[model samples]
Target chain A: MHLLVCGGTGCRASASDSIVESLKQELENKGLSDEVQVIMTGCFGFCEKGPIVKVLPDNTFYVEVKHEDAVEIVDEHVIKGRQVKRLLYQDPEKKQSISDSKHMDFYKKQIRIALRNCGFIDPENVDEYIGRDGYMALGKCINEMTPQDVIKEIKDSGLRGRGGGGFPTGLKWEIASKNNADQKYVVCNADEGDPGAFMDRSILEGDPHAVLEAMAICGYATNASKGLIYIRAEYPLAIKRLKIAIDQAREYGLLGKNIFGSDFEFDVELRYGAGAFVCGEETALIHSMEGLRGEPTIKPPYPAEKGYLGKPTNVNNVETFANIPVIINKGANWFNKIGTEKSKGTKVFALAGKINNVGLIEVPMGTTLREVIFEIGGGIKDGKKFKAVQTGGPSGGCLTEKHLDTPIDFDNLIAAGSMMGSGGMIVMDEDDCMVSVAKFYLDFTVEESCGKCSPCRIGNKRLYELLDQITQGKATMDDLQRLRNMCEVIKDTSLCGLGQTSPNPILSTLDNFWDEYVAHIKDHKCPAGQCKDLMKYVVIEENCVGCTACVRVCPVGAISGEKKQPHYIDPSNCIKCGACIERCKFDAIIVK
Target chain B: MSHIKVKIKEKDLNTIKQICKSFNNEPKELINVLHKTQEHFGYLPAEIQEVVAQELNVPVAKVYGVVTFYSFFTMLPKGKHPVSICTGTACYVRGADNVLQEFKRQLGIEVGETTEDGEFSLSCLRCVGACGLAPVVLVGDKTYGRVAPDGVKAIIDEYKK
Candidate 1:
C-alpha cells in the first residue's frame, strides 16, 4: 500500500515535510518500509483539514495529521490492518468518520477538470505527467491537426478565457493567426495579482506541465513558435516548478524543434512580473513582455493584431491555458456540455475570506453562489450569518443575499454589477462591513493604478478619498452622490480593464447595500462596528471582574479601574484599537 | 526626455550581456536581466530597459509595463531591505496602524518611503495571507507577526543584526 502525503505549499508550511519524514522513520521502525511506499503529492483542496494523508489501494483518507501522529498511523493502520478512526476526518455535520475523499461534501461538488492532476501526480515528475497524457495535446496539435483545425476545435468547445475577461479562446487565436507577422508570439499571463487569488499559482505549482503543453498547443493554433509566461517574481515555488517542467519538456523532445517527431516547433519561456496588478491586462502584459513600462495602451489594433515586438500575439492567463489540453483531449463537444451555453467548462476559484473550506475549487460555470458558499465552501465560518460574497478580486463586485441564487456565469455575473474576475471568491459574513469592503477594493485599485490615464489615476484617487471620508464618518449625502457619479465616469472613461473595473466593488456594494451607506452618513454608525472611528467602546458594569486584563493590554491607556472594581473605558481617549475588547476575559468591553 | 538615444554603457552593457548569457538566450531571461539591471542601477532605467529588450529579443514596451505592474518591483531606487506592514482586517484590528506609525516615527519616512540612510523602505500590504498571527510586518524574508508599536524598533534591530 502507498501512503500519499499532501506536499502542497499550505501543508508544507504546517510541517507536513516533517510528518513525511516521521512516517518514513516509523515505517522503518515497524519494519513495514518495504511493504509501504510514501508518495508526496499536490493539494487535496480540502485545506480546512489539511496536512492530509491517504492510504492508497484501500483509499483510507486521514485529515489534519500531525508529525506526532505518524507513528500511530503506521503502527495501527499500516501494520495491524486496522484504520486509525481518530486520525480520519470526522464530518462535523454528520458527526461520522469519513474514510474516503469521494464521500466528503467538499469533494462531492468539485469537478476537477483543470485540476485533474493536482492531487494525483508529483508535479516535478515529467514521467508521471506524461503518464496522464500531459504532452499528448501538443503531439496531437502538431502531428494530427493543423493550426485552423485546432482553433476551430477550441471555438467549437466554446472555451472562454478563464482570466476573468471570459473572451473566446479560439477567436483570440484566430485573430493572431489571421494577422500577418513574421514573428508571432503566445503569452501566458501568470501574473496573478489578485488579493485573495492563488488559483494560477497553485496550477503552476501543481501542474506546470499542463500550462506548458497548452502553451505549445496554443503556439500551433496561433502559428506562433515562441511563447512567454509572464509570472510574478513573488511566486518562487511556482517559478521553480515551471522552470523544471520546461527543462524536462525540452529534454523529452516535447518543447524544442521537431516535437514528437513533427515539423511544428514550439517552445515556452518565462518573464517575471514585478507584482503589478495592471500587468494582468493583455495590452499591459504584452508591453511588459517587450521590456517597457507595464502600462496598458488603447485598443484598435488589439494585442492579437499588434502585440509583442509589433507582431501578432495571443495572451491567455494560466487557468485559461490549463483548460485547453482538456478541451483538445476530451473533444470540444464533451466540454461544451458541462456548463452554460455561453460559458463552457469549469471555473477555478480561490475560495477565501469568511468561508470554512478556504482553498482552490473548480466548479461548473452555472453553479449558484449559494451552492458554492453553503454546499461546497461548507458555509460561513463559525456559523456567522452570510453577508455578501466578493467575486473577481479587486476587479469584481460584491453579491448580497438577494443575489445568492444567481447562477455564476460570465453574463450573469456582469448583469449583477460584477464581472467574473480572475476567479477570486472572498466570502464575507455579517460581521464584515459592506462600506469597508468597497473601501478595501478602492484602496487596492488606487495603489495599483498606473497613473497613465486621468480617469483611472485621478478618478480612482477621488473615489478612494470619498471612501476614506465615508469610513471616517465625515461624508455628507452630497459626497455619496459624487462617489456614485465618479464610479460611473471612471468605469466609462478608463482606458484598460484595471481602471474600467476598478469601481466594481463600489458599484456592487452600492447596488446591494445602499442602506449601509445611508446609515453611515445619517446615523454616523457602522452596523458591523468595523469602522473604528464611528464605533464606541463601553464597559459592561455587570460582566466586569476588574482583573486588570484590559489595563495590561490597552496600548493607548484607554481603560482604567481598580483591581476589584468594574473597569471603565475612556471613549474619548480610546482609539478603538480593539485590544481592550480582545483582552477582556469577562466580556465587559462592548463595541457600540 | 529627448528620446535620450540612451545607448547602453560599456560596463552596463557587459553586465547585461553576461546576465543574458547566464540564462542561455532564453527569452524568459528578460525579467532576470531587468531585475539584475535594477539591482545595479537602483531602479530600472530606460537605457537598461532597452538593453534587456534587445538582449531577450522582446519588445521594449513589454519590459517597461511589467516593471510597473508588480508591487515587489520598483522603477525607482529603493533602500536595502523592504519592510512591509500588513494592514488587512486582522492586522488592522490588532493595532498594525500604530506599528506603522512607530516605523514612520523611528525611520522618519512614511509608508513607501526609503530612509535617508538607505537602510530600510517601509510599505503597507493588503495581507500576507497570514492572519492567525495578526499585526505582522515582513522585513526582507523574515515575518514578525503579532508585532506591537513598542516592538517595531526591536524587530528592526533584530533585522540589522
Candidate 2:
C-alpha cells in the first residue's frame, strides 16, 4: 500500500510533516514498512479538510488526519485491511463517510486538466514525472512539428492565457514568432500577484516539470534559445522545486542545448520578483526581470514586439504554460472538445473565503458558478447566506447570486462585471459588507499602485478614500456619485492593465450591491455590520453572566462591572476589537 | 529608501561587493543583487545600498528606488524574528484584520515597525497561497495557520523565548 500525504503549503502549515513522520514510524512499528511506502505529494486541493492522507490500492481518502491518529491509521487500515471509518472524509451535507476520493462531490465535477499531475505525483522526482509521459510533448514538438505547426496546434486548441488577460496563448506565441529578433526570449510568469490565488504556486510545487517542458516548447515555437521564470520571492518552496526540476531536466538532456537531441536549444533561468503586484503585467514583468521598477509601459510595443532587453518575448503565466504540454499531447481537438466554444479546457481556481470547501479547484470552462459553489464547494460555511464571489483579485469585480447560474468562462466572467483574474474566487457571505469588501480591495490597489500613471496613482487613492468614507459611515450622497465617476476615470485613463482594471472592485461592487452602499450612505449603517465605525457593541442585559471575562479581555478597559454583575461597555472607549465579544461566555456582548 | 546612512562593517561591505560581482555587476540584475543583499543583511539600509550601487555602477538613487519599489526589501532592520500577517483576500475575509489588530495591540507597534527590544517586527504580505489555512502568520520561517484574534498573544509568546 502506498500512502500519499499532502505536502502542499496549506497541509504543511497544519503539521503535515509530523503526520508524515508518525505515519512512517507507525508503518515500521506494525512491521508493514516493506509493504507500505509513505510518499509526500503536492496539494490535493482539498485544503479545508487537510492534512489529507490517501491509502492507495483502495484509495481510502482520509481528511484532517492528525499525527496521533497515525497509529490507528496504520493499525486499522494497513495491517487488518479494515478502513479507518472515522478518518475517512465525512461528507459535510450527507454526513456519510466517503471511502474513495473519486466518489466525493468535490472531485466528481472537477476535470483536473491543469491540475492533472498535481496531488498525484511527487514533484521533486523527474523519473516519477517522466513515468507519466512528462517530457514527451516537448520531444514531439522538437522532433516532429515545425514552429508554425506547433503554433497552429495551439491556435486550434483555443487555449487563451489563463493569467487573467484571456489573450490567446497561440496568438501571443505567433506574434513573438513573427517578430524578427536575434535573441528572442520565452518568459514563464510564475509571479502570481492575485491576492487569493495559489494555483500557479501549487502547480510549480506539485508539477514543476510541466512548466519547464512547456517553456521549452514555447522556446522552440518562438525560436528563442533562452527562457526566464519570474517567480515571487514569497514562494520559497515553488522556487526550490523549480530549481530542482530545471537541474533534473538539464541532466536528462531535456532542457539545455539541443533538447531531446533536436537542433532546438532552450535553457531556463530564474528571476526573483520583489513584492510588486504590477509585475504580473507582461511589460511590468519584463521590466522587473530586467532589475528595474515593476512599472508597466504602453502596449504598442508589447512584450511580443519588444521585451526583456529589446528582444521578442512570449510571456505566459504558470497555469497558462501548464496547459501547453497537455494540449500538445492530447491534440487540440481533444482538448477543445471540453469547455465552451470560446474558452477551451479547464480553469483552475483557488476557491476560498466563506465557502465550506476552501481549496484549489479546476473545472471545465462552461461550469456554472452555482455548480462550483453549491455542488463542488459544498455551499457557504457556517450555513451563512451567500452574498458575493470576488474574482480577478484587485483588478476583477464581484459576482452576486444572480450571476451564480452564469457559466464561468473568461467572457462570461467579464460580462458579469468581473474578469477571470488569475482565478482567485473568494466567496463572501452575508456577514461580509459589500462596501467594506470594496474598501478592502481599494486598500490593496492603493498600496500596490506603481504611481507612474496619474489616473491609477491619484485616482485610485481618491477612490479608496471614498470607499473608506462610505465604510466608516462618513460619506454623503455626493461622495457616492463621486465614487462612481472616479472608477470610470481610473478605468479609462490608466496606463497599463493595472490602472485600467484597478477600479473593477468598486465598479463591480457598486453595480451589484447598490442597496448596501445606500444603507451605508442613507441609513448611515453598515448592512453587514462589518464596518467597525457603524457597529456598536451592546451589552445583552438578559444573557450577561458577569464572569469578568469580558472585563479582563477588553484591551482598552472598555468593559467594566462588579464581579458576577452585568458589565457595561464604554461606547467611547471601545475600539471594536471584538475581544469583549469573543470573551463573553454568556454571549452578553453583541454588535449592534 | 532611507536617506539616513548607517555605518556598515567592513565584512558586510565586502559581502555586498561580492554579491554584486557574482551577478557580473550588471545594471539589469539590480533586483537580484538587492535580494541577495537583503538575504545577507536582514534589511537594506542606505550604506549597503550605496555599496551595491557603487559595485553595480548604477546610481545610488536608482538602487534606493529599486529597493523602495519592492515591498520585499526592507529599509528598517527586522527584529530577531519577523512576524508577517497575510492580508490576502482569503485571509482578509476570514477575520485576518482582527488578528492583525490583536498583534498590533499586543506588540504595541504598527505594521512595518519593530519592537523596542528587537524581538519581533510586524508586516503584512499578500497571499502566501495557504488560503486553506486562512489567516496565516509567519514568525520568520514558521507558518501559523488559522490564527484568530485571541490566538495572537499566544503565537507571539511562542517566539518570546
Best model per lDDT: 2
Counting clashing residue pairs in each candidate, in order, gives: 29, 0
CAPRI level of candidate 2 = high
Candidate 2 chain A, which ten residues in sequence have the lowest lDDT sum?
A579-588
**Candidate 2 lDDT tens digits, A1-592:** 7999999999998889899899999888878899998988899999999999988888889999999999998888888889989888888778999899999999999999888888888899999899999999998988889999999999999999999899999999999999998899999998888899999999999999999999999999999999999999999999999999999999999988777767788999999999999999999999999989999999889888989999889999999999999999999999999999899999999999999899999999999999999999999999999989998999999999999999999999888999998999999998999888888888998899999989999998899888888887888989888989888988889999998998898899889988899999888898888899998999998899778888887888888889878889899999998877777778878999
Error of 2 at A582 (Å): 3.0
What candidate 2 gets wrong by more than 4 Å, as runs, is A29-32, A540-547, A563-566, B1-5
Model 1, runs deviating above 4 Å = A28-35, A541-545, B1-31, B37-70, B74-123, B126-161
Across residues B1-161, which tens digit of lDDT does each residue of candidate 1 receive? 12334556788788877887787756645666667667666666677777777877778777676565556656555668889887754455345677887888778898878887788898887655444345668887666766787678797787573
Give a tens-digit lDDT track for model 1, residues A1-592: 8898887666665667889899999999878889998877777776667778999899999988999999899888888889999988888799999998888888888899988988788888899999998888877877788889999999999989999888898998898899877889999999877776677877888899999999999898888899999988777778899999999999998898988887778888888777678889888888777655678999978988888888888999899899999888999999999999789999998777677777778999999999999988889878989998888888889898989999899999999988898887878888778898888778888888989999999999999989888988899999988999999999999999999999999998988999999889989998887888899999999999889998998767888999889988888898776768767777888888
Top-DockQ candidate index: 2
The C-alpha RMSD in Å for every predicted model, in order, reads: 4.7, 1.5
